[model samples]
Target: MFSIPLVILVPSAYGRMLLRLANTVKERSDIHLQIFAAGNDWPLEKVKEMTEAGIYKGFKPFEQLKSDFQQADAFLTVMSFEKAEEPFMKTSFTTKWLDYVPYGKPVFVWAPDYSTAYQFAHQHRAGIAVSEDDPVALVKAMIDAASNLETWQAACGGARKAAETVLNAEKIHTLFVDRVNHVCRQSQDTPNIDDLKELAR
Candidate 1:
């Protein structure tokens, strides 16, 4: 009975990966799939292709993102499926994952085995992480998320906790300010490198 949308908001850099994931879930009648353009650089053809294929409603911006996400049945976060991008995946966390967490929605991430985002999701119990190379695994996660309300709610609670504790904007900014202040204090106490070199000679 959860007939809302499964939303994906991406920066337009990973159109092919989005398409692959959308295609896997296109046929579900229980929910619709929507891809929202996060930034301005999305490929026009890829957008057109998804629309034509009926995998996604279309690429567009929501009038109110928070409200839109609140209404969504679930969320998606994905990384590139290419083996060449494995190094990037291993080190990076997608912004979409952070954005989705605060909404308390069940998130599905398709990422490489070594991805930090994948590991974080699994560790925090915040979302479901599927191997990017395994379409079946992605499909199964989707179905499992869609079919079970209790599990979905539990994931949402975990995601909300993660957003509040680790990814909160205030906490991150405070940490940044503290680090900056520490560096400034250290610089004030340390002798200048040029002075040290001159003294050595």
Candidate 2:
């Protein structure tokens, strides 16, 4: 059986959910998961525990991390599924998404339906979006992506297109300038307090 290599870079605070994901992946034989836990918040003891348990492959240095991502078959990014995190999840986009876009690999977005990551994945068709909180659902998404080579290739192409079009630096700069000019025009068109008072009289 051929195993698909999936790489994920973990931020400091998301370890709890990450552990759940790791454990779930461990039970599966088709997906080989490698996690790079980045930042100081991940305690050394906890890292050792997960490593010994075979769920974690240990922290990779900066250079090796880039190499691993380049070699991996696919990428994964996640947002918190908790209700308390809804506001942040909906409004903010993770830099991980941007990083994965350049890799030209399929991304598995495990997040709530309302999350920005989920919406972006759906809009671009660049990856599989699993809005369910279940780890099983995430694993199923991985299997589906690995099994369908045609769809996988299409997703890879979509990612590259997204980078060239919507995420392009020049396009973003122009959009920002246009927004600022529109705001200035709206401010100029609004009536002043003195104008309103005179009209009232």
Q: lDDT of each model, Cα atoms only?
A: 0.71, 0.74
Give the per-residue lDDT of model 2 (tens digit) for 35-129. Answer: 76543245677667667755576556666667777787888888888888889999988666666677787878888999998998898786688
Q: Candidate 1 lDDT, tens digit per residue, 9-92?
A: 554446666656566656666546666654334467756666775555544455566676877777777776677777887888
Worst 10 residues of 1 by lDDT: 1-10
RMSD of each: 3.2, 4.1
> How big is the RMSD of model 2?
4.1
Cα-based lDDT at residue 170, candidate 2: 71
Best by lDDT: 2
